[model samples]
Target: MSTTTSTTTRSPDAIRGRRLGVLLVLCGAIFLEGIDVAMLNVALPSVRADLGLETGVLQWVMSAYVLGYGGFMLLGGRAADLFGRRRMFVGWLTVFLVFSGLGGLATEGWQLIAARFVTGVAAAFMTPAGLSIITTGFEEGPQRDKALLVYSGTAAGGFSIGLVAGGLLASAGWRWVFFAPVGLAALILLGALALVPKEPARPGRSGQKLDLAGGLLVTSAVILLVLGVERAAHAGAAWTAATVGAGLLLLAVFAAVERRAAEPLVRLGILRSGPLVRSGGAGLLFSGGFFGFQFLVVLYLQELRGWSTLETSFAMLVIGIDAVLSPTVVPKLVARFGNGRLIFGGLLVAALAYGLFLPLGADWSYLVMLPGLILLGLAFALVYGPLTIVATEGVAESEQGLAGGLLYTGFQFGAALGLSSVTAVAAAYADPLEGYRAALLVPFAAVLAAAALSLPGLRRRAEQPDAEALPGAGAGAGTEGGTPAGAAAGLEPARG
Candidate 1:
């Protein structure tokens, strides 16, 4: 009989080197998925000209992809838990690359749009599944934190590269951009196979039944919502109202299905936690506001200022820099102000940033945008790590995956609706500055709402003892069996 001896003397350098290797793979995969998100947008105009497409057909290219990504996000998170993460990772990567190549070869808008939809479906699996890879590979705490920072860093960096590439490739012809990601995808796929650890068989793996009805309803709802917002400028009040009602009805049904499903896509109780609830709402609001600022200014830069695509791309780098820089700054802010203060303060700053943009017009200089960009970037920094911490902080270790998915999903949906909201307000008013001014108000309102939601933590419920004892409280998240102690505390036992 042999007894295995546990060794605690392994060198720290060796352990770190291995982690570094794993982090690169995680970052690389995540970067590809993210760049893909905005990469095609950069090339859209070129794609339209090349395909000889009518203006109306161009909508399909972006819409198809967004529809696929949003529609499948909830389902993808659960799928990772069911199928082996490595298997899904490889599967999605293969499909994403294939579609990329197809889009490159396409001669017509229809072919490109179809390919984009396929790519989005492939990416839905790729992104969250890629995230699952980070979850299982890095043991939680510092190592995990470091790796996630790197992933965020990579995503931010990729967006920058996407801008540069979009500018260069649009000049060189857009196919180069498609080919670039394909080559990058091939490299990442090879590295993943060799480096990504094999995931264990899931405890109750029935290979994802995937609430089809729920998925379809949610997808339709989102599409209708986006379309309604886009058409607000064209559709009469009656038509828009009808679209809005139908979308809400669809979403309500989707929620009900999730509430009762044995393997619900979204665990509704997770939202019951005060912190998660606050984080979700604030995230939605904040992203909406952020995107609104971006959309309004982009138009100002191009339409009013007569900036070329390349010039605008370079100017936009300020926002990109701040987006990438925030994760690095968050930990220090958390140490100083605590999560709640940072969150509130961040929103306050963002509201101010938007206020600065309201006075601009056709005569605006590049210098005028700087102060707002700096303030906006600072606000962005305040949110990244603090919100991420709040989101997963109280999540049970087992539910960390769910928390991560839920947290980002809030941002994604918020981004979709929020950006749309800005467009609607702007279109409604017809005055550019007035519309942007109104859109900025959304973030300000969200900051107030988020603050109210968080105050409950400062109070004690009659029977509930201390705030720390709250189920799904911050302290309870991400503990035990590599799970967050909080979000998982009341979660139904691990789905088998």
Candidate 2:
């Protein structure tokens, strides 16, 4: 009788040391990506002054990045799954690093806009790839939650940090903002290649071809949808309707393509799962609704209030501080009250924060806004982790990566789409402040929707067995993911 002994080989990233290294690399990538997203907004006036860009043209510099980031996010997510995650991650980081230099070197307005758009594409890859790594590397539950906090926190915090960094760099010369991130990216890429633990190929699945048709359709649909929302302001009422109609048509086609593809770009069924639908709803609300807040406030501070660029950046630091500590408290909340009451409570809290801003007039002090923004950040902290956990909970282990990517897709695209809609509203109304107030209500409506989506999951959880809380409902022992056993995680286990 011959019995075979099988050896298990793990990628460095799949282990502890490699995981830490990769985490650091991802943090850098996330920070750089986020910084680019916000950096341009902070320094737009400087760019306008330097390149002779008209005031209206300056908005394009910001939108160019958003369009690329939102449009291609899913494609980027697919790329990570198709190619090795590490290969694509390193490649994207390198591109972003290279382009920061290009953006810095831009001598004309169009040149800078083009460079910013390309950087957005590079960011598309880095964001998903980093998330894929985190989701693949960590197990579900508390451990994974910690990493998500860090990952999500970096994005939230980076939004603020970008402004600070942009101010300093812009003062030196607006180009340095581009130059500095490129250097850091190069360093992070090298470290990521060396330290990011790579997961071994799954036994049944390893290689697959790209769904080019699906990618193009999805990307184009997202871009057109976002643009139409923005264009509804001035493109004539009929053009607005047509643009939206066309966007919907492409999106419907993209859905069909995904459903029929041999290796579908998006796993449609997973997206429809109970937890994921709710999580996605929350992501849509927060990412879209909240994203516009900073964009509007930065303008209010710099242009409307006449604060120095650096001083304005310094003021928003409260959000990062609150977000870092907020998520850690979530597990305790879940343990005590369950997800339903808490999530609804959080959303209502966030709505209140945004609503408070509506009443502020031209003479209102920055101090008044600070408290509301802090409350908003705190509300975000409460909902972020639990919602992420719920999003992946109902799926089988093999599908976790796909779901992770999709949920994030909703997150990025929703925010981008939301911001565009709000911007159009503000611009159309011709009273930027009033427009901001009007837009504030949109997120409030969105949170109410998220609360509705999450309610079902919360009720469902009440009926599941305690063992179900364990990895693969306790079938998997000592595995990172909650599967039959021997599975690894994409990110850390869900925290708290």
Candidate 3:
């Protein structure tokens, strides 16, 4: 007791070095996940050509991964909670590396599809584990905020960079797209081993069996739901209806299972949180709008305008501005305006941009599209980080991985539905320009609906003290033995 000292001076260089190491490994994982998704999208056509995949089978190349990733996410997240985070992270990364290489070696369509699905499953486990580590490892004020901003910006960067990288790799050969991730995964694995700390075994998780029944029910439901939405564009109406109906039935069963489970894959009680519910809904709409708009724009540029892959990639690079703005500018805005107002405003801006694009012509220049693109990028920076904060802030450290998984599940599901629905709507019209205009309306309405949904959050925020009165609003506050003050403030409504 006599030797105890409360504080000691630490070198700035040592502190900075430690934080940088943590950020690099965490950001590297997120970046790889983002790039893998986008890279495959760009290389799909080339993959089909090389394998001589049938038109009906070609869509499965994308659909398989979506299904695997979306379906297994809950199980993955819960697994991270039960297993050590570092253990799950490194193990899953190894799985990802192996499968990505397998994908590159596949000569047949089904083999590639299988590889993609397995790789997606690996990512499902890896992503939430990485995110939870960052959320829990960094103290919950500015240090965590800065880390999150960098993490999110890196994610956006990976997607943008992948668009360019995919085009370049596909030009060499479709297989290279798959092989490239292998090399990146190996490097990331080495870095993770060197830098990511080993988490101790959780106090009570040693002997618990995974909720196998719950996992099966929920995974089946998600797989079916995604399949129905994805095929709605091309499959028969009756078939799509049957598939979606079955999915809903399974979801009901899953809900019942969760309520009764000894170790539920998801805690049903988490749904009682208003902020979590609102964030999930808004995330769904935001992701839907973003993905749908991208789908429409890619079709317009490449199919109608007859641009090469390289040209389309470059034209879309404007969205990468979110990468820079998110880390540098968004934190200041969040501190000033709070997450609710900023998310609301971002949605409205996105709505307006989509509306502005409704008047597109067959021969409209990239200059004409530039304004909407830039606005979309800015909106993403404003919205995505705040949305993440809202979703994960009040959550206990134990369940942060589950919360992250839920948010991403909504995102993947929304993206699947939005892209398919908009493509179907556009395809029904014979005139190309008419199709483009018609398609734009779907996302416009989606963004507007999301904005309307944000009203509850805004009203709740209004009832709280001004932002300046908050403990962590203007400065860093240490998280010592309890929840950060900012997190406590966010959890007030939930505790009600």
Candidate 4:
């Protein structure tokens, strides 16, 4: 009898070069996506002027992108899982590049909107695919933690950098905002083709079909919900209420479909995971508050105070501090104080920052807002990175894409709600100062809610072992014997 020699094929984590390359490429792609969003907002007025668009039609340039991004995310995430992640990522990136160029070239309002919508759809697919790659590619330990922190930091930086880039570019021409992303995206695509590893096919996914029924219902629900929120801000109550009701009904239907489908777009059972659910809720509130606050601040600084776009961008740059802090500072903090305390503390700090803004006056000094802005930036550095870790930690490899998608869904919906609700509240008051003050309340309350939601997670942390004591807790250079981050966080190890 001969003994068989078995070969153990190590995961991509074994190679440092490939892992770093993949992370850098993903960060670049995510950064481009973030910049694309913020830059467009900065150029919106210019876009309207250049295209001779009506106020109503101009809104669509922004709304069309949101609708496509939020609506198609679930379908896109599931497609990454079922099809190949690399294939989906590269293909969608190509689409994004092409449409971004189209958007830059478009003379008509409708043509620009169409290009934006398609680009958003492409981002829906590309983002989750990139995130799933990170979740699966890196070994689940400090190494992975470091990568994620960098990822989160880059994303925040993109938004901040985008605003500055937009202001500078818009001065030259509004079209450059769209054209810039094309060049950045093309470079990333070439890098990805070389650097990103091709995800191996899961054993059972080859024969599986997409849950089209679930996709349609969910997409329709999201689109309707977003429309209703925006309509409530601008239109009659009756139509808004009807639209919202229809969206709720479709959401209920989608849940039912998911429960019955052989291969569901979203596995309903995963919603039962407390960490995932709570993290999603907290992220929602956090994002909503941040976006609402930003919108009001921009209006206050630029429109009311007559500050130039460049000045406004510089004022907001303090909020981008997270890009530096996350990769450098947060990992050490996470290893010591834990994610729960940091998230809760961050939320409260952010709330206090917004609270300071509640005392706004027509001739307030920039010095008065400076402290709050710095605090808010610190809060973001503390919160965004760890919240992401919690959201995707417990999930299996196969469903990591779905988990990432759900977290981002909360983010997108929260932003829409926050911006729309605050705008509506502000519109209700005749006095501009009073309207701004009233709008400030929305973010303050939102942060309070986020802080409260984080309390349960602290209890969840107590139930688990010490993060350092757990296997792979802070395994710096060596990979053996330590528990992965998820298991340390009280979640099971991922199954292939």
Candidate 5:
């Protein structure tokens, strides 16, 4: 009789190596996502000149992508769980590749915007699937922690690297910005095909279907919410308020629907996980504060100091140190201090970084700015990876895609809110310097609020003997047959 032991037991090194390959593939995809945005931002002037586009139409190129990405994220996450992680990831990646190439070939502004929107939708599906694969592939604890840290670091680095790359590519032609990602996406797709493992066959769910109604409500709500925020800087107050209010109403309706659905798109109980909830909140604040700060800094350097794109990129490149420290230093810190303490500490440091920069002077030398930049990088290294780990830690494997989606949705929404709020604040002031200083407060306050939000997690950690013993932690903890102990009951097979 053949035994299962021979097939199941592999050398530890082989497993480690395989997992490493998977991690690299996922990291590449995430890095591509990060870089894609930054590169496009840098190329906007060129794109406008080439297409003879108005400023309002040019802005749509970016806004279209954000709306598509944020709107469908939750649906994409659930789709991965229902369909298959590898299938969603691989399929959407192909879509991303195709659209990116189309974007490079576009002759008009509208065509480019359309291409970017579809690419963003593709990313919405692919990113969560990639994240879920890592969370489910690696066992919880040190191994998973290390993988996540490395993944997060690569993502952080991608933006910093993209700035320099965008400058170079834009010099060549704006089309190169779009063309570059096509090549990178192709490479990542090849690697994913070779490395990303297929999902194991399992028994089909009996009767549950995808919650189409719930998905539609949430997507509409999020799209409206993001659109309102994005337009806040440029649109009138009446329009923004109406859009935002409608979004809130739809969100409430979505919650009510979720409470009664037989197979809800998102299990509302997952939100009850204190760690996950806190992590998501913190992620929102962290992303908001960081992006807002970056926006102000870019304006200061480019508009105020008359710095070139390359010069600004190089100066800001110091902040990319998080990319290096995340993979190498953060794992050690997480092992010693725990994710909660580190997140708290990171927020504190981010607040300090913003505080240091609040005294911005028109004539200030780079030396004056270096401390704040360095601190910001350190804060990102500490916070970003830990937030990701905490968010996904307690979620069931089947729902990990959902968890990733929720975390990233918070991040995207926060970025939009932070940027728009700061932009509006800056525009209100007569003096440019005064406006920037006033705007700086937005991120500083946000970081402090995030620090406050993380306090409950630290308290919970202190009270629990085993950190993983928290109410929702069982799904991620050691379990028989690679499934969470209690997850089999409510799960229905996903419809293709």
Candidate 6:
């Protein structure tokens, strides 16, 4: 199914302006998603105090969202392809808006959790739709590259800025955190209605059917996997083991089902593309390391050092500098070094940042941690956009949403794994300081492994002919032999 926008007789400059409007609308939607999550995290303590909830139940406030998001993401992505990207995005954004407001007015703990879960599911659908729209709308070249860089930078900035916003809003009242997104979503929805172009009709899309069996199986498997990992730090060993083992078994079954299905929800062949696969792996490791590190930092500053939430937020705000650098600095770097080298370098710098912070002192000043924070921000600026470009570059337009789904699935699972593993390790030690020191190694090692994973791609790019090696060449040069092996068979290049 094609997602191309219909051509008009508008002037070139007019078309560019419309495309820019669409990009901004989509970026606003993503920014809303990022800040929504960050704001809720900050307000959790207030929710617990107000609702008088148990610790385990309070934790579910966050876990429910994660479960809903991670589980349904693959299904959501494929739905955009089979249904319509614009339809899915607009519909889901409305759902997100309503539910976010409901969460704000929630009088009971379960009410809030239910609202958050639905909101998360809405995001699972909306985010990929927005991303796929950008991928399909922009011609794959320098133009697409810059659009993606700006989109990613906005998302990072939202989360960073949300930290400060959340703290300030929570001070007013916890409900304000939930209410704030409502306003943002309403504005973004209006922009989307006005700016997002209508999807061109595909010849046979109306007759196409989604692989319901495959979708069900894969969704179940992902939900189980995410839930098992999330419960690992809290649940009993036997329970966690059984849950994860069952998830793996279901995944194997899902794989078998996809191979036999007449129209599989996911095209397994796309997984064979070397660059796509590498990008997915790198995304997983990078997110895992970054989030795990952030989690550890929060704990050390708040619990260990008795720092206020606002104080900690300010200290970590340095990492948000990526929001500034990604759209500006990284594009020039990508033009010179290509995505592969930049991703590798980013991973190495992240590892170095983690290593520099390995020493855990009770009385360490903010000055001591400042350099590491700056390095991490730079590393994120370098990695996030390039990884996104590599993941979707050569995939068929029909499966762009699926490609996005696969990438984000890795990121979500990696985050769950990293957070769970480190929490488990930290709990094992009697000495709090010693525990934090040991936990720090988790992110450090994960980043090093990510760097190692990127090496092969760099070497292959180095060996390629100069003409083939040009930045953005693989994306739009032509379809002759540039497409991935599976994509070359029947898939067509995306139409602008």
What value does the lDDT take at residue 418 in candidate 3? 91
| lDDT digits (tens) for residues 1-496 of candidate 5 | 2345653464321235556777899999999999999888777878999999999999899999998898999999999878878899999999999999999999988899999999989999999998888777776667678888888999999998998888889989999999999999999999999988777665654355789999999999999999999999999999999999999999999999999998999888777677778888999888999989999998999999999877888888899999999988898888788889999999999999999999889898999999999999999999999999988875666678898999999999999889998999999999999999999999999999999999976754443223332333443452224563222212211111
Evaluated against the true structure, the overall lDDT of model 6 is 0.83
lDDT of each: 0.66, 0.69, 0.81, 0.83, 0.86, 0.83
- How much lDDT does candidate 1 score? 0.66
Deviation of model 1 at 432, angstroms = 4.3
Model 5 TM-score (2 dp): 0.92
Runs with alpha carbons beyond 4 Å of true place in candidate 6: 1-15, 460-496
| Model 6 residue 21 distance off true place after TM-score fit, in angstroms | 0.6
Top candidate (TM-score): 5
344: Cα error in model 6, Å: 0.4
Lowest summed lDDT across 10 adjacent residues in model 5 is found at 487-496
Residue by residue across 63-89, what tens digits does model 6's lDDT show? 888888888899999998788788899
Query: How many clashes (backbone N, Cα, C below 3 Å) per candidate?
Result: 24, 26, 0, 4, 1, 0
Candidate 2, residues 242-270: lDDT per residue as tens digits?
Answer: 87788899989998888789887876755
**TM-score between model 6 and native:** 0.91
- Candidates in order, TM-scores: namely 0.83, 0.86, 0.90, 0.90, 0.92, 0.91
RMSD for all candidates, in order, please: 5.7, 5.8, 5.8, 6.3, 5.0, 5.7
- lDDT for model 4 comes to 0.83
Worst 10 residues of 6 by lDDT: 485-494
Model 5: pairs clashing at backbone N, Cα or C within 3 Å: 205-493
Query: Where does candidate 4 stray beyond 4 Å?
Result: 1-15, 460-496
* Model 2 accuracy (lDDT, Cα): 0.69
